[model samples]
Target: MSSATQRRVFLVAALLVAAVALGVISMGGIGENLVYFWTPAQVHENASKAVGATIRMGGVVQADSVDWQPDTQALTFTVGESAVDTATPITVHAQSAPPQMFREGIGVVVEGTMTDAGTFRADKVMVKHSNEYRAPTDGMAPADLYATVEEL
Candidate 1:
């Protein structure tokens, strides 16, 4: 092959190697920073691998499972599937006051790591709102729906 052709081939090969190296390094960083999103059921299924790994757990808060102490700002709650009784719930503990919209049966996503004791130590809690809006049903006025807001 001509010297010019050989030089071009070597340059192309070097560029390819550099591109591959950069891709691999970026992928490694992404893998380390990735936080998996899991439901309560999935978390239970992957309990062994999930322990101590940062994750985001999302599900509906179980009714009557929220316990918030104002004095200590400790909040503990259980998250489960749409039907709380259908699957085992994951316990989540956070050291901050929950959002005002936080309530039983609401969808929530907590970001944190799972403790060895199987509890999720949440550093951030986010309330998930429904995208679909429904009008008041029969016998319920629009004003009735706003009663809770009025009380607040």
Candidate 2:
């Protein structure tokens, strides 16, 4: 090929390589920012590795285990199945209010990192609803946000 043609080809090849490299770099950042999910059993099994690691957990809201301090908007609860053979129970604590669908017998997904105290300090709370059923009127105010439960 002529000198001019060769120069143009080289420039094109270099630009293609540079673009590929830039795309890879940007993707790497996105992958690192992505969080993971874990179930209550898995969290307990891998407590050390899960410490300070952001993850999501799913389980049914334990009956009568829910507690809320209306004055401070603080809440604490235990979630799990009634059968011991199922996933282990987990405790969650949060300063903010939970989603509107959250209630007794409903499943939930709590997103946050585990602390040394063994409490999951939830940054986000999700509710699990069955399609066949709808919540009845309880004469209570609804929450600000709602999220579907996602299994870890």
Candidate 3:
């Protein structure tokens, strides 16, 4: 081959190898950086895949499901939609106190790694929306709802 062509080929090969190496390194960190979130149903469906994986499970808090031990500050509760098919629910165990917004029927995202025992040891808990948006029902005039937004 011509010297010019050979040089071009070597440069292209080196670039390709560098790209692959970069891709592998990035892939290794991707799992740790990614926060996988799923509903109760989704968790059940992908239970095997989620095993031992760190992820964020998003769901509504089940009403009257919280049982807190005052001395230990240990809490047990159901986190997910009530209509979930799987009987297996996420049991969150935190060493410290839970967030203020952590309550029954409120949306939450628990960040932790799942154990083979199905318990999630959460290091952080983020309060998400409850998906309960309601308009004023007290017979307010139609002008009231949009009054603030319209003025802005």
Candidate 4:
């Protein structure tokens, strides 16, 4: 083969190797940052694989399971499936203050990792609000639902 042709072939091969290396490096970074979403039941079912990995756990807050300590800004709650009998509840502990909308029976997605001791330690808690909107059902006008401005 001509020298020119040999040089061109070498350049192409070098470019291909560089491209493959870049792709692999990018994929490694993405894999480390990737967080998987799972329901409380799913997490429980796959507890062995989920422990020590960051995940997003979604479920309804169990009634009477929330315990907040303002002095320490510690919040602990249990998340369970909508159908209580279907799956066991998962307890979550978060050091941050609970969101203003946090309440029992509401859906929540907590981002954290499950400990070996069988509890989830959350760094961020997001309240999942319903998409459905409804007007006041008490036969009162929308304006009546809001207290007088003077009350504020």
Better candidate number, 1 or 4, judged by lDDT: 1
What's the alpha carbon RMSD for model 4?
7.5
> CA lDDT of each candidate?
0.87, 0.76, 0.73, 0.86
Task: Compare the candidates by TM-score and give the number of the best one.
Answer: 4
Runs of candidate 4 with Cα error greater than 4 angstroms are: 1-36, 83-86, 136-152
- Give the clash total for candidate 1: 0
TM-score, cand. 1: 0.64
Identify the runs in model 3 with alpha carbons over 4 angstroms from their true place: 1-36, 82-88, 130-152
**What is the per-residue lDDT of model 2 for residues 1-152, given as tens digits with 9 covering 90 to 100?**
99999999999999999998999877767655553556677789889977798778777788787898889999898877542324578789988776766787787888887889887889888887767854635763344222232311
Please report the TM-score between candidate 4 and the true structure.
0.65
Q: Tens digits of per-residue lDDT for model 4 on 12-67?
A: 99999999999987876765456457888889888998788888899989988899
Write the residue-wise lDDT of candidate 1 on 1-152 in tens digits.
99999999999999999999999878767754564578888888889877887889998999889999999999999999774655578889999988868999999999998899989999999999999787777999888768757766
Candidate 3 lDDT score relative to the true structure: 0.73
TM-score of each candidate structure, all chains considered together: 0.64, 0.60, 0.55, 0.65
